[model samples]
Each structure stands twice: as structure tokens, then as C-alpha cells.
Target: MTTPTLPENGEHLLARATAILAKGSQIEIRNLVRSLYPAEAAFVLEALEPEPRASLWRLIPPGVMGEVLIELNVEVATALLAITDRKDLMAATEQMGADGMVDLLHVLPEPLLSQVMESIGVHNRNRFEQALSYREHTAGGLMSQDVLTIRADVTLDVVSRYLRLRGRVPAGTDSLIVVDRKDSFQGVLAISQLLTHDPHTKVSELMDTKSPGISYKTPSRDVAALFERRKLLSVPVLADDGKVLGRITIDDILDVIREEADHSLMSMAGLTEEHDMFAPVVASAKRRALWLGVNLLTAFLAAWVIDLFEDTIQQIVVLAVLMPIVASMGGIAGSQTLTLVVRGLALGQISGGNARGLLFKEISVGLLNGLIWAVVVAAVAGVWFHNPHIGILLGAAMLINLVCAAFSGVAIPVLLQKIGVDPALAGGVLLTTVTDVVGFMTFLGLATLFLL
Candidate 1:
């Protein structure tokens, strides 16, 4: 087949694919998609809704199905797999890397999982099971059993000849793993060194021994951080006894980083990163309703706080006019601090060592900002309503609420994390609640004491 001109990016590819699909020309659509890479095709599939996605999925050849399926999101992949026949699913998964297969298995039904396991043969089945043994978001689960290991005693010439005999190395193969006779990992022999160094040099002599191995149980987040900090191409996952289980490549690390970003963004809204953007209306609503209900409850709590000063609101109509400003400013301020703390926690930047320092820093920031904005808002309110007393009361309230907001923003995430709750999912609601209640109470309470 002649080479096809590739689209510039995913969006352009998607647009062209949509145009082809819109024409109802299956052959043209298939031809156009066949030329795209698995990852690109996966992106297209993700962008398309279910019905069109199914039609496109059928056009992809079986040879690339495993790769394409692996690239799609777990929910989307499972949906497609549900429609596929047992034989086809087996065929598609048979060629997948250990980590990819493990990922696919996590979403598969038990019966189908069994059948898939039966087809993978004994050696691969053990590897798959070993990988599955780890939590899905751990280093072992993210690693592939497919590795090229060489004995440390071997010379570069011997290692080079062995690789030649094997015909091809694995993708992302930057180094040959060096291990002892017992299969315990020793070090890594760089591919560059293998190609450039004296062929007679011993693997042990040339290998990089200082590079650390990731424990099989290390969290996937930590794994991604390691790859980033070390600028690693791949790292070995090791058993407690130092035996090598498999390897995690830079590709896997990239996936972890992307998922983390998605997770952080989604969790702020009390949603998971895996949520399908175009899921059925009822299903989507049902999932969202839970968070909505939580937010509603918090809203009621804030309303109750406002209700406590209901007469105050009535006594001063101006207070009713200006209540939202205090609450809104506090909410925005608290959200900023909360987001920073959450991000710091996620990156392992904040800990016991610096927690007190950070808390002091955030509160100090809040005090400074609160003073500045309180003066601004107070000036605006005093001038607008021609009431200096009201302006002074509002200013004090703003300063008080902002300081409270800063404290809550710093404290909430740390407390939630300590209690094993995800701060990202819960922090915003709590911070908003605190800010609103405190902002309203402080402003109105001051009004009650002075204006009443």
C-alpha cells in the first residue's frame, strides 16, 4: 500500500475520521484509520460516541486490535470488549504485553478472565498472575514481565551475540538488565555502552550499579516521580529478596502522570478520572447526583448559618446586598490555598518536616491579602451606601473570614489525608462550607453587635 499523508494531530485526525464516517463509507473510514498509529486510533475511538465507536472498532484489523484496545480508557475498552466475541478477545489480548494484559484483566468479567487466562499458556499465565497480584496502581502492576536480562559475569561480546540470537529486543529497550546466577538483579548495562565499549569488557565492570530498583509494591505515583527525578528510561521492579519481577518503562510512567493529572482535576468535582464523558444520561446523572447531594447538604449548612442571623439581615437591607461578597471572596481565597496544599501533598512536597512552615506561610498570606481586600471592599461599601459604620463592620468581617479561610484551607487537606479520605474530593466542599459559614457569621455577627 502507498503511504498515506498523516493528519497533524488528534483533532485533525478526528475531524477527517468524522467526515469519512459521516459519509457512511466504511471502506474509506477503515483505510483512513488503518494508517494511523494505535494511540491515535484510540484517541479517535475515545472522541466518538458508542455507536460510531463500535463501527470504527470493527474496521481495525485484528493484528493491531490488542494495542489499540490497550490504549483506550478502561471503561471504553471494557465496553468494546463486551461486544467482542470470546475468540476475538482472546486473539486481541494474546499479543499484549504483561502490564497491558493485566490492565485489561482488571476490567474483564470473571468468566471471561478465566477464559483469557486459559489461553495465555502456563509461563505467561504465571507472569500475568504475578502482575495481577499487585494493586493495579502499584509498580508491579505497571511493569512488564518481558525483559532482556543478562548474567553479570558475561562479557559485552557474549551479550551482543545473545541479543543477535534473540532476533529482536523489546520496545523501549535502552539497557540490558544484569542479574546474578540466582536471577537477583545486579545492575544495568547501557545499550550505548554495549555498542561503544570494548566488546571484551565484563558486564559487571561496565554496568551501572548505583541505579535503584523500585519495590514491587511502590505506589504508581511514586514510580512516576522516580522516572521524572531520575530521568529514567526504564526501571526494574524487584521482589523483597531482590529478584527481578519485571520492568516499568517510560511509557507506563507517562500514563501514570496523565492519569494523575486527570484524577486531580476530576476529583476536585468529586468525580473519578475514569468517568466516561459521554456515558448514558441516567448513569451519568446517578454518579453526579451523589456529589451534588453532598454539595447540597453543605449548602444547607451554610444557609443554616445565615439563618442564625436572619433578623440581622432584615434589620440592615444593605447587609443582604453585601453578604455574598464576603462569602464569595472567602471561598475563592480558601480554594486557592486548598489547591496549593493538595498539589504539594500529591507531589510529596509537604510533610511533617515543613507542615508547620507551610501552615504559617498560608496564614500569613491570608492575613496580608485579607487586609488589602478588606480595605478595598470596605471602601467600596462605605462609599456606595454612604455609611462608614457599615463599611467598617464589613471590613472587619472580611479580614476575619479571610483569615479563617486561610486556616481551613491549610488544615482541611492535611486532616482529610490523615484520616484516609481523599482531600481532593472532599477538601473543596469543606473549605467552601467553612468559608461561607465563617464569612457570613463574622460579617453578620459584627452587624448584630453594632447595627442592632
Candidate 2:
């Protein structure tokens, strides 16, 4: 008997699911969903609009729903959770990891959360509560309580025998964590060593003591960095007194990396990482309206700057024609610097010791570029307007605006971070305001003084 193969890519899966959904066959939909990985199923669900999404959701197996829910975007997950029965939700989550359950509880309604809490086993409930106590964006929240550990004094034979009795360990358990009698983390014993070594060897002799346990309070972003730099498959989370709390797997780190990437991309447009593409129209509009309003205010401020130089513009119509070029060039130059600084901040590459060096380097680049482009623009303006004075004014204005833009580009993000504002969200608006005002004031001010 031959079975069918599912497409590996999400787009193909979405297409197949959509086709099946259009046919409105419950059996076909259930078969399609049941065959997919939780993440693939989640992709198909998110790709559908609300009505079809609900239809597909009902077709997913109850055991896999918790996992699929974990894979979904926050808004989508929240929406799905709202319609699910509390007892059914608890049943779905019974086999879920403690960390995943904690995340779900946060988005669940108060009544649903209470019902689920009452239904879960006492040990699982305690772990969930512990995970929930920590900030969501920290190591503690991301760590799973289902850690497999061994005493440092145990022999490899004892470890192997104990593992055989337990049946199976959690996924991503590349090494067994070594702990002292007090449960303080000692080191790790690799599974390869456990399988290959002479059974008589003491666990303490073969354990890698150099591996460090991550502090529970560490930010999730920093934790992701550690995983990246160290190439860790799994790392132990430690309490303040050095007791082991849980383990953070590579899977959890992947989620953190995805979230940070999403955040950086969205924040530039003043949007949240969890923003749902298929969110209701009014809700989406409300979120975007605030950002648009902020941009409008900046636009008005730039216009006001130009209004002050209206007399110069009216007299020499060429000045008005050439004005936008200056502002546009300045804005582009500033945005390049701003993007670099924001990324540096996100990667922890920018620090107090090196920030001044980066600023100096950016300003120097601006000066060099401004000088080179200034001559080209000046020559173009002179040839086009048939006025050498207009050329000189345009050149000087370009140089001033570009230099200011470069300075603002580097300075704005740094200033925003110090004041606890997200540079990605606020930096573009502020940078545009600076470039427009300076570009207009410098170009038109020069023309007013010399050409007028």
C-alpha cells in the first residue's frame, strides 16, 4: 500500500489545505491536518481567514492542538483559545511541556485558566506557576521543567541502567546535566561519552565542567545570543544560589531568535511582532493610526520649516524644484546609519566603550559622502538653472543637511535607548523630521540670503 507525501514548504501546504477547505470535506481536512507537523498545521491555520481557520482548527487532533497552539502567532492563538472549552483545553495541554502550558495560561481567560489549573497534576501546576512567575521574555519563562539530570558521583553503568528504566528522556537531551547532592549544577556528561565509555568510569571524571549554566533572570535575547555563540543544543537554567531550575533547548532558542527578528522588522514600521496579518479591520486600523498620526505631526513640522522660507521659494521657482532632492538625499543617508546602529544595539555590539568610535566613524562617512555628492549636485543645479550662484547655494545646503543627517542618524537611536524608547519605533519619525527641517532650512535659508 502506498501513502501520499506532504509538501515540505509552508506555501505548498497552505495551498493544499486551502483547496481541501474549499471542498468542505471534514474527513479530507482531518487527514490533511493529522499528517502535518504541528508547525506546518499552524502555518496552514494562519494562512486561512477566520471562518476557514475555525473549520481547519476543528479538524486537528486534540492531542496535537496544544503544540499547534504554541506554534501560532499570539493573536491567532488567543482567538482560538477563546472558543475552546476549558476542560478540552486542559486535556490538549496535558502532554504539553510546562513552558508551553505557562504561555497558554497567560493568554487564556481567567475562568479557563482557573479550570485548567485545577485539572492539571500538582507537580505540573507548581512548575507552570514557577515558570509564570518569571518575566515572559526571560530564560526562566523559556526553560522547560522536564530536565534530565544525574549525580556527579554515579558511574556510567548506573546512568545507562537508570535511563533504560525511565524509558525515554526529553527531546534535545544531548547531554545529561551533572548535579551535586544539594542539586547545584556541576557540569554535563555527553550522551556520546555515556554510550561509548567503559561502564566502570565515574560520571565526575568524564563530565565537562567548563560548561556554564545560564542565569534564570537572563534576558531571552541574551540567552539566544549565548546559544548562537556557544552552539548549545541545551543549557541548564540556574537559580540565584546556583540550584538548577530547568533546561532551555535549541528549539526554545529558535523561537527567541524568530521573535527578535520579527520585532526588529516590525518595530521600524511601529508595529508589534505578534501583529496578525488577518486581524480584524478596525483593530488593525487602530494600531496603525497612532503611527500615522505621529508621522503626520512630523510632516507638519517639516512643512512649517519650509513655510518660513516661502518668500525665497516663491521668488526663485528653481529653489522649490531643487528642494526635495536635498531632503530626500539626507533622509536616505540618515536611515542607513540608523539601521546599522539599531542592529548593533540589538546584537549587543554597541557598548559605551565603542559607541563614540561608531559615532565618529558615521559622521566622518557623512562628511566625505556629503562633499563628494555636493559637487555633483551643485554642477547639475548650475547647468539646469543656468545660474552659478544657485549651484553654490545648493551645494552648500546639501553639505550642511547631509552632515546633520549623519549626525542625527547615529545620535538618535543612542539617545532613544538611553531614555528607554525603542529606537526602531521612534527613530525613523524623528530622523525624518530632522532631515526635512535641516534640509529645507539649510537649502532655502542659503537661497534666501544669497539668491534673493
Question: What's the number of clashes in each of the models?
Answer: 0, 0
Q: Model 2 over residues 58-130: C-alpha lDDT tens digits?
A: 7677788888888888899888887776666767878776666776777777777788888878987786777
Q: Report the Cα lDDT for candidate 2.
A: 0.88
Q: Tens-digit lDDT track for model 1 on 362-421?
A: 999999999999899889999999999999899899999888999999999999999999
lDDT of each: 0.88, 0.88
**Stretches of model 2 off by over 4 angstroms after superposition:** 1-7
If scored against the real structure, what TM-score would every candidate get?
0.95, 0.95
Instruction: List pairs with backbone clashes in candidate 2.
Output: none
Residue 415 of model 2: what lDDT? 94
Worst 10 residues of 1 by lDDT: 94-103
